[model samples]
Target: MSNNDSIKKTIIVTVLLCIVCSVIVSAAAVLLRPAQVANKSLDFKRNILSAAGLLEPGKNVDAIFNERVVTRVVDLKTGKFTDAVDPVSYDQRRASKDPSLSTNLSADEDLAKISRREDYSVVYLIQDENEQLQKIILPVKGYGLWSTLYGFLALEADANTVVGLVFYEHAETPGLGGEVDNPVWKAKWVGKEVYDEGDVAIAIIKGSVDSSSSNAVHQVDGLSGATLTSRGVHNLLHFWLGDNGYKPFLTNLKNGEA
Candidate 1:
């Protein structure tokens, strides 16, 4: 073949190869998208179950989740459930970034230091066979020592007592800030009172909680050697449970107004 003819042939082959590769990639993405979404949803349900202390060893997460948990969307400001948003498809993190769906936080009100906050949030409800609400799980996130920590805080129906707490995502030092995941540390949160006289009063103390102290009901033992992470937990709890967070929803629920 002449040099010019050979060059043209080479270019055509390269272009065809690129086109074929792109088609394959596009097809794969389309085919796998549903599974990806399902898995993401399953993982989220698992986290919710874990926070509610309903997760069991070797159990099917989907089955247990569907049987035990009910998902609902709440308006933070109004403290009311609204059918305007679908709980199954609502993405709180994504909504927080949307200008129309979120509100900017002031420095004083931003205890979690989350500058932008979503106006609506998803809450998980667990009820007994009688359909009486037993527990409510709230999603919470805040900045930790190295990165933001995202977690779920489960409360008893009374609204002030904690049932369980779990951090599903974070980027903190292993064995230090990472100790937040320690089952023992998490256990300390159980039965801790989150509110005092209608105020958010829970605190992740600097060290061990003093059981004899008057404020012991609102205190949980801090993560050993993870002061920053512990403080992040404290701030996030206060932020999410306070007036700007779910306080209105919780108040309504407590008053039977919800």
Candidate 2:
């Protein structure tokens, strides 16, 4: 064969190899998608359970989730339960970018610095054996120092007292802002009050919380050496727990209307 003929053959072989590799990758992705989704869902449920203090080692997440957790959709502005949307299929983060499902936030209302806020959100409910609601887990997210942090905040039935807070995803400097995921810091939020007399009062302080302070109930010790990240957490908590987030739903819950 001439040099040109050999080059053509080589080119054809390379093209065919590329095509085959692409097909294999695409097929693998399609085949693995369902399992990926199931695992993602399981992880999410496990986080919700953990936030509610219900997760146990060696327990089946799906079984425990089915037995104890109920998912509900809430209209953020009205604070009312709505059956209009399916909780299991709704994506709050995606909705925030969809004009019809979200709204632009004014500067004053956007403490978390999220430009748009979803109108509806999914809330997880944990109930006791008698079916009495024990805790409500609300999904929360906001920009931290370097990246957005996504987490679950669990509150007592009263809707004001925090049961637990956990950030499952974030990109921040390790040992600093990333400390938001630190178990010890998260534990500080367990008993903190999110609201004081109907106002969003909970704050992440710059230093250790003063136990003797009158507002101790509303304060959480900030992540040391990560002031920006701490402020991000504080602002996001206030924004979510405030009127722009879940305040309406919580208010209705308090009034026995939800």
Candidate 3:
């Protein structure tokens, strides 16, 4: 047999080909990293704008976001606005996994089912030219039936009324829990009240809300056949809006302390 066709030669060629391919792939990843990061940032900005209902279909996302949004960091424990961290550089999701940056949760306290929560969270504020808050968008995440769902919850300045809710990432089952992405279902959250008489009264009910029911304003229809996911949504919302989460911040905000 010819040397080129020999098993040893063929093995050598294959190894060399793999080495070349690996180098190319590594180089491409390194060269493209900045673009990937930029795209991810752009998508994040879009999601924030979308959650606040401030996104215009044909308008420049960056320009519009810059014109209306003010990013700030909030101390979860104090419920106060803090300048200790740079809002632009803060990485909350990463912080959650760091013991120094976050706090561990007990089973009872972790209604959202996140094992740990960051000590500080970034919030987006949509303000008028006068600097008065219009809408406040807060980040939230929790495990669904299958995977962690990350999203924004925007509220009117009162902090009790929802402006919009959108999950930017999730791995829920298609046609079931995935219905959370349905525009029609998301629309149902637009006017929902987060608090009723000083309590977190909002809920994703098992069935459709009765329009005529007195408590309908705080109820959302659960996704059919997705009970666990529905429960996770309910729990996460409550956890985020309750005393251990944004409630203190909302109080400070209303008092002009945040």
Look at candidate 1 and tell me the lDDT of residue 115. 92
Q: Could you give candidate 1's per-residue lDDT for residues 44-103 as a string of tens digits?
A: 888899889999989999999989998889988799888778887788899999989999
Model 3 lDDT per residue over 76-190, tens place: 9999999988888889999999999998999999999999989999999999999888999999899899999999999999999999999999999999999999999999999
Candidate maximizing lDDT: 3
- Candidate 2 residue-wise lDDT, 1-258, digit = tens: 699999999999999999999999999999999999999989989999989999999999999999999899998878999987888778888999999999999998898888999989999988888988789999998888998889999999989889999888899999999888788888898889988888889988878999999999999998889999999988898899887888889889878887
User: Which residue ranges in model 3 land beyond 4 Å of their true spot?
Assistant: 1-5
lDDT of 2: 0.90
Q: What CA root-mean-square deviation does each model show from the true structure?
A: 2.4, 1.3, 1.3
Q: Distance (Å) between predicted and true CA of 3, model 2?
A: 2.3
**What are the per-model numbers of colliding residue pairs?**
0, 0, 0
Better of 1 and 2 by TM-score: 2
Q: What TM-score would candidate 1 get against the native?
A: 0.89
Error of 1 at 35 (Å): 2.1
Better of 2 and 3 by lDDT: 3
Number of the predicted model whose TM-score against the real structure is largest:
3
Look at candidate 3 and tell me the lDDT of residue 94.
92
- Candidates in order, TM-scores: namely 0.89, 0.96, 0.97
